[model samples]
Target: MAASQKPDNVAAVMKVFAILEGLAAQPSIGLSELSQRSLTSKSTAYRFLQTMKELGYVSQEEESEKYALTFKLFELGGAALEHVELIPLANVEMRKLSEQTHEAIHLGALDEDSQHIVYLHKYDSQFNLCMNSRVGRRSPVYSTSMGKTLLAWMDDNRAQEILAKTHFIARTRYTLTSAQQVLDELPGIRQEGVAEDREEAELGVRCLSVPVFDRFGQAIAALSLSFPVVRYEEQKRDEYMALLFDAGKRISSGLGFYDYPFSRS
Candidate 1:
């Protein structure tokens, strides 16, 4: 970034960036309102808006008198999404896993921009294991087993940052609201290569997930299976865990992990 002539500081950059983010967060933003909400002088705000307009980042609305973002961001992001190769590479494998276990299977990657679990595909279970969940939907990273599987594998500093921003809302009674407990389980989850949610997101819904790595040895996403909690009582719990681990291993191997580093078969 060019050093600004005007005695640059974090506060100044934050204010300016907040305005841009505010506009991006919503569909449109107006001139006077953007200045007030961003807590910046009208002249300074207008100058930045004009700069954004020239850079093809923001556009003016004729009737609403609002500014909206352009396609510049997506043009940058879409390229990376295409390169992941999980959509085509993992689709058939996900279907096979779902069929094998008679439970729903999902493929998700941590969306860096949103810090949420972005579902790539959701293979329907034989008898509908939680029909409520949708493909392309995002769940909080700290709330889902599929999310925690990846989060637990991350380094401490990165995990702390994630937990700091994470809201940890108890979607159901079983949800982990305390980061301390979740952090405590990181080591075991990392060692075992599997994570579980016993009715955490919703009542009677249990899920088990294991991490899927990329060629770069990064935990890119997780392969998960979900079933009703009642069905997983006692002896059945081990079976469910095994099924998720086996499928996760297959998916990870297909993604270029010749040998899954954790939880041997």
Candidate 2:
């Protein structure tokens, strides 16, 4: 609080971020150049750089001694993006789908190990009865429409790898119990551009899902509409599928996947 004393904490934070911004603007730089870019003394920049390096956000090349940002920042960005970017983008489409059908809509993504689907967001149906689910709840990938849609879009090798680790305990009589059985269904799901859970994960609950692709054409998530069997109208299946696919395409487009693979069948 003394006049002669600087606000050490605030100054240090500013300097650290200044250095990070400088490093980000350039591919790589030595301590002297980095100090100039960040507008700090070489010693101060070096101190901050060393700390950041230890924290894995900055790295110095072995041969050049030039410091640069690392994949850690990219990894952190991706992690932040999943919740920050994806949910908001998907929520817009989910709300539209919910309005159209007045049915439960869900946005689900693969968990860290890729063995399960975790609900990231949902819109409850207008009806008194709907699927009991919440954000962050995890479900087996083999028994849910969202899970099947995600798997159907994955390459066989990767799909097989995930299936190899999956425990195919039958959630219900309709649940596919073997990897081969699910594998056999993938082609049809892919061809139809949608997947169905015919009371697979839970009795009397039927769901349909379509893939939400990312810029790289990877199925980053799945969008689904769920209804109790009593509320489901078999004749309106195609209509519901169209609504889900429309939302999926819109959401995928917002994610930078302009060429969504799914087409009406």
Candidate 3:
């Protein structure tokens, strides 16, 4: 075994983390002091620092030959925090929507690949025959109301790219099974400020969704209400849409988007 290498490379990993922590503690530090603080050799620390610098997690000052933590780590942390913050901020409005309708309420966001919508938070319907779903569940983007709402608000080129990559499997007879069919609906969805799934993803289940925007006015998530078709009333659609739109606006405002484009009137 190499002197600097530990069993299964654990020591190397620890040394890297230790150096990171040391750099975090100091505004800037020299190679000698950093290696000593991290309990690693100067050569090992230099190699790790060079790797981290290349990865954008650390920066080196040319004049002083000192290493400092970079904002890349902070930016990653901020993104994670923002996602975490979204749940609580959205839950408040979700709870209100649940109380108002006693129906299933879901908060969904685009999955990492932009090919699906993942449920992040959900409030089950009070009724026994309501839609069944859980957090972390994923559904195809072309067939779900939440998915359409997300796609509708996205930039045209990006939305087109995602649509092009989608596998339009027909989950139900009503599912849009082609890119053109899905694309044709986006304009109306954007105009109405809501999207609908008329038993497209699952039989007897209908969903209505509104876009939730971020600080940049980009849609970050979709707030949706689901109901059994038996309980869904054509006349009451507007009433439910109002509730969802209100909730979407509130959650978006919490995320720093005040210019919610949808109006109930």
Candidate 4:
């Protein structure tokens, strides 16, 4: 417990991760290029690639001998989509909350590439929020409730790094104009464990959301409820905020993750 693991003993795992990462960065790659890029010896690269192929994480093109990722990676991700796991749990709860409040519910995760909210699930509200976003759509994190909840939990430096290259697209009059304003709101968001979007993403939409944290206190995803601003009047903001937070916590607990403010991992 007191000693660091020896390098040679963990080299195999490290090599595999490097290979996977290299493959991930490229659309498709030949073995020679992969071996060179990953800096692993050809034999070692081929051995690990063969292992990954068997496991269905990598596949070789029959036409060109190039390697690409396979749906087996999705199979691995599917482990996290279990009903008691994060994705499935969020999906079901979002539907339940949408039915209960008659407001659209959504789940989003922070994408490493754009720091945008990558949509996962969207529950239709009976009252119709009029949003047409679907799964796999990307929205600016600066103005979206999903983005704000996850960003509100990030550390100052980490958040700045993400938003630095980020272009603050003004989707509406209510969209946040600068990173400083976003940084300022984080403290209060951290205190309350919830974030609100008042017509930030659109002219008439209002969103209330809370982050879904893992057992390690990392915000891997977020849960949100959206409705028309006319429906979620200022008088009801606090009440609706409470309901969304409760739903967020329930899903977190249901996933076996204790709800806490997200740690900047």
Among the numbered candidates, top TM-score falls to: 3
For each candidate, what is the lDDT?
0.77, 0.90, 0.92, 0.78
State the lDDT at 16 in candidate 3. Answer: 91
Q: What would you estimate as the lDDT of candidate 4?
A: 0.78
Could you give candidate 4's per-residue lDDT for residues 122-159 as a string of tens digits? Answer: 88778634566788888888898788888877777888
lDDT of 1 at 210: 86
Candidate 1 residue-wise lDDT, 39-75, digit = tens: 7888888888888889888899989879888898677
lDDT of 2 by residue, 107-174 (tens): 99899888899999999999998889998999999999999989999989999999998888988888
Clash pairs for candidate 2: none
Q: Choose 1 or 3, whichever is better by TM-score.
A: 3
How does model 3 fare in lDDT? 0.92
| Stretches of model 1 off by over 4 angstroms after superposition | 1-84, 128-131
Worst 10 residues of 2 by lDDT: 1-10
Candidate 2, residue 155: the lDDT equals 89
Which pairs of residues clash in candidate 4, taking residues 3 or more apart in a chain or in different chains?
A: none
* Preferred candidate (lDDT higher): 1 or 2: 2
- Over 4 Å off, model 2: 1-69, 263-265
